[model samples]
Target: MGISPLNCGWGICVFLSLCLISFTPPCDGGNILVYPVDGSHWINMKVLIEELHARGHNITVIRASTSLYIKEKSPLYKSITIELDKKVEPFFIQYLQKHIKAQVEGASAFTFFKITLGFVSAFSQLHLLMCDYLAQTLDDPTMVKSLRDSQFDLVLTDPAIAPGVILAKYLELPLVFNVRWITGGEGHFAIAPSPLSYIPVPRSGLTDKMNFIERVRNVFFYSIALLQQRLIGPHYDAICEKYIEGGCDIISLLQEADIWLFRSDFVFDFPRPTMPNIVYIGGFQCKPAQPLPVELEDFVQGAGEHGVIIMTLGTLVYDLPKEVSDAIASVFAKMPQKVIWRYKGKRPSTLGNNTLLVDWMPQKDLLGHPLTKVFVAHGGTNGVQEAIYYGVPVLGIPLFFDQYDNLLRLQQRGAGKILHLSEISQCFEQSLMEVLHQDSYRQNMQRLSDLHRDQPVAPMDQAVFWVEYVMRHKGAAHLRTEAYKMPWYSYYCLDVVLLLLAAVTLLLLSTVTMFRFLCYRCLRKPKAKQH
Candidate 1:
């Protein structure tokens, strides 16, 4: 059945025409641009992008750093990495401006030195780096103009990175934010627990009073949050030489967003508020199981005899203390179950043969294994999600920040046990035994896993829908609200009521003091006259 040259040419033309018809333009793919907070943050996002691509959608990624995408080994290597002048450079210029302004004859060296040096020390802190970088990025004119020219219909960002919110507004686009961590406010999502529950809210079931030390630490944390909003944000604007842009305010942006997809589960027990836009797609980032590596196959296969416990503290918090590692080793020494700890950093000498210590392991794959019974991990959102997806019980040893929150949520759900950092030294063996032996934890995990698996639509499908929906609706502006634009005083009711109460209380105190003073004077005069 040899075809003529003319027939072959016609067949080629037909194939080309079909592909063109099926291919959607980049702009028509609902032109969704996703700007994750960091490269690592994109792991969950990749699952959603794959789903969207399957649906014949086009996506563009704008990354904060190249390192994030490089590590993922994604096929989509054609990504745009955003570069900015060093974050510290702006602070340097601002300090110079202040130093120059204060260089007058009246300006004392003490004042100048104190002001300049104080900021220098503060700037040295590593926590300020991301915020500073975001502030500077917003200040660039060409970058801002480029975003405007792109005309992306929807902007997906993590709230941790403020620039995404600002850029969304600059382009007059609707936003969909992945609330990766908890912050205060309605419809806020956290892979971790909310600090608000620690406050005395009735029925919250948290009754323990904070110690002086705990209170001080909390105060410091809150102060940093305030400083970011008040100082760093405006400082960013000053450096950018532009007023803040985006959907007007945080509330407005949130309201205007087509969807607010949280990477949380119903079992995690996040504070649920009644909002149309808010959707619980927590385990959406997790997809169906993939196969494990060939080298690890034997260990996983041998798991059913005594069962298996997978221990991993997640990638972000590696290099645990020597004491903690020793405690873990002690537990592994006793356990009959084949323990596979994803031990990062140099392996300590105390490790046992029953344990498999590897630099990294396919976490989701391990959880999915039928022989796997429990997960021993540092409570992270990613870890929690994986555990839920596979119905694996957990022993969560939270180190700091949202790890505490994430661990607490698992505890409340009865899906896991919360091991204090201190317990890692003394009670490590006992805690591991309890976690492994407990039937309730395992059952709870299975229950949650079922709920997560039974969602009406997969997280990827939901994310893809909202993304394209924004483009279809030309930026879901109808969903936006006026609450974000209200003045702070109005929002908190601090302006009028608090001021009136203060004024009235001071006036009454003054009157009482004056009356007492007059009475005392009269009594003294009478006593003196009699004498």
Candidate 2:
């Protein structure tokens, strides 16, 4: 009679909560060290770091003092900032401009060679700079001691600039890479078996299925990567010799990683041979749309049934050339759809009432908005993945460095259209209008979204599970292949091929000798009988 109904309900709820808590497995977290490449790659690394930190692990980021995007102060991770002699930030803009100019002028064979040589020279120099920074980091006694004393469970790194790979080896820690591009082109080329017959080389601008000319082009570009690697390898080899005990190369170190949380999956990337340790975590950063800011929400809603288009060229190239911008602005002016362009360029004289230019954007939130119909992007991995996540069709304007290739995959899937800078002035209106009116673009993208979403585990959750798996297991040596330790000649079985060829040659020679000896004896016998 004294027990109240409210107290009975509260007691029941408490019992259920206690049961649920008891059944949930606890996260046995460990200390994790992160080595991130700044800019867009950092964005990827940061997402993984956020998840790892949320799971009750400690994170330490090794950053360069000259880092563009990475901050020295952050609540998420303790940073060990390394000193650099000079910042290459200003040089990047110059490089971008020159790269654009080179692509435009690449109509001639002379400029093609010039471009290839220029690229090799520029990248090799940049590789040298990264090596120099690694040398500095290693040379610092206090830095090395701090890293060793930390006794981290693993080193999480973006291997685009692979100081982290070396550091992981030096510290004798378990290695995990948040990777798409390693030191040598695409990550697959570093560890997986990439057959040039079908798998197009990065920057070759070809797809999986290629004709004769395209195959030649793939070989040519792959040759370029090989040459560049040859130039880059010596630098890393020297670092391995100096810093790493027992001496290991960058490629070997990469192959030895405990896990590769690759930011690509079969949904986006072509089907290719992959190893067990490679975990596909595409679209891990994508989530349901958060409510936009009041003004931006009003702008999106203003489009009504016509819907809206979102365009961004990422952080590096916010401003296009004046001519290109004018052409784009003029085209946007003609569209019935409202446009939110993330541009920092001079206001185009042709910019219309339907268009709004902002310096920054909540890109993920905007893409996830229901009214977002078209995404005009530079075909970044993140942007493309987000577009796929939100089921938004794309109108791609690829600037440089895998951007075209990224869009090409979407285009091949019938979900996007690519507008090269060279074509923007003449055909921007045509390309934009085609993508705007095309129903298939939206339909195909939605299909991809469905497939990507129809996974057993969300990509982010899968990625976090793998990270924890490494920590719990100490390292994932069982998943790793022993092919890395084999000599190139043996790995490809060139030795077997040579031995087989040698045996065939010997058999033929013996047969020929026996035939000649029989003929000689028969002729001698005939001559003796005649005598």
Best by TM-score: 2
Ten consecutive residues with minimal summed lDDT in candidate 2? Answer: 522-531
Give the alpha carbon lDDT tens digit for every residue of 113-165 in model 2: 67567767777788789889889888889878877888899989888878888
Q: Give the clashing residue pairs of candidate 2, or none.
A: none
Please estimate how well model 1 matches the true structure, expressed as its whole-model Cα lDDT. 0.64
| Lowest summed lDDT window (length 10), candidate 1 | 199-208
The positional error of residue 174 in candidate 2, measured at the CA in angstroms, is 0.9
Candidate 2 stretches with Cα past 4 Å from truth are 1-26, 102-109, 112-116, 511-531
**What's the residue-level lDDT of 353 in candidate 1?**
78
TM-score of each: 0.71, 0.92
Query: Over all chains combined, what TM-score does candidate 2 have?
Result: 0.92
